[model samples]
Target: MTASKDGSSRNTLQSELAPRDMTVTEEDVEPELSEFTTPVSPLPATERQESICAWIWDGCSMLEQQLKKKAIKTRFAEVLESEDAVLAAVTLPKFKLRWLRTQDRKDKAKASLLAECRKLVLDQDQQAGTSTSTPTCHQSRDSAIEDEFFSFEDEDDTSSTAESEVTDYFKSGAQEIDSLNGFALIKKISLRYNAATPSSAPVERLFSLGKLVITPKRNRLSDQKFEKLLVLRYNHWFNS
Candidate 1:
């Protein structure tokens, strides 16, 4: 009994007298993540939203084509299946029209030509406005009269080109919003993840760093400790 007691005391003494550990740095002991963030933009809310919508258009177009290595096409409305996408697609075109009117063209002959075209359009619009006095019920009939008047005016000017372009654009836009006759099936085809700025690149990079940092030499870490370190590193990124 005394021998067992002495052996237990010696073991306790040896454990207590073991070499003291060197100080560990928070950085050396725990994983660290670099700072990354979204920058603040100075644009107005409407302008910002318009910019975002345009980017979405560019993204969706590329997603269906460049990323897939196929000749796929998709309408803005059907691609996202979200209310915001629909609103952005519709409102963005209207905003573009208003925004275009504010451009400052600085060519003499071109400016004069544009001025003449604008006058013709205004005059055509005025004639339609005056003819609307025929009758409220005959408004439908008056539209045919106005169309003829506008057609006559078109032959005398290059406004025909502008007007045709506008009509064609509107027609195409109408078709885009048509699912049955216009936009067809939008497949969620696989994108080239390795070839583009995927949404998960940032997360994947951090995970790769995690793999590198959690080495065999540091494999003694408990799961709870490792998780705490990850959370700390994540928070540290934003905090710093």
Candidate 2:
């Protein structure tokens, strides 16, 4: 009985000496996401709502602007749909008119001549007022009117001459065409056309496929066959 009592006391002493399990409590352990969670700026309820609304409105405004820009780019309006309008814009007749107006020999010459005619008329009118004889006054007034008419006729002649020169310049051969102002104008227009982005990843991938298809072995493939093959390769439903 004493041995059993002693064994029990020893077992209790060993158990008391054994390491206890250290349980983690809420206060003892830090939250795993405590470092990641950022403290939000404190704001009044109404002010926070207003800020959120403003952010949403800003996003909507940006989306609307993008949609409007896309519409303008893709929409075929009445002006753009007209073949005559397209031709006129490309040929740039209005541009030619503005260009001619800046020339030293054309517009400047006409302006100076017109100014001289006005001065002459003003001088003659003043002389007619001062003249003693009635017939002399009438003759001066008639001559001034004739001079004004002649000046306008001269301007028309100059304009027709300029148009002829411009026509002849455009009709000239390869050497002359290279030196033309119209070539430079077309170059500027081409740059604007080339700046447009009307393609995406799918189109780019199609081009890569084209390079593969147009190899030395398949270089003789007809345009129709090439197009059909490309369409079939890209569209799974078509092949199925």
- Model 2 per-residue lDDT at 240: 64
Q: Write the per-residue lDDT of candidate 2 for residues 1-240, one digit (tens) a residue.
A: 999999999999999999998998876556856767787765777798999999999999999999997798578566554543443333343332233333553444334333433444445556876785455554677787888777866556545544554455335443432344644333333244334557697778788767756779888899999998777766753356
Cα lDDT computed for each candidate against the true fold: 0.51, 0.57
C-alpha RMSD in Å of predicted model 1 compared with the true structure: 31.2
lDDT of 1 at 14: 100
Superposed by TM-score, candidate 1 places the C-alpha of residue 1 at a distance from the truth, in angstroms, of 99
User: Cα RMSD for candidate 2?
Assistant: 21.2
For candidate 1, the lDDT comes to 0.51
Q: Candidate 1 residues 166-235, lDDT tens each?
A: 3343345343223223211110000111124549877886796578558889889988988887777767
lDDT of 2: 0.57
Clashing pairs in model 2? none
- Backbone collisions counted per model: 0, 0
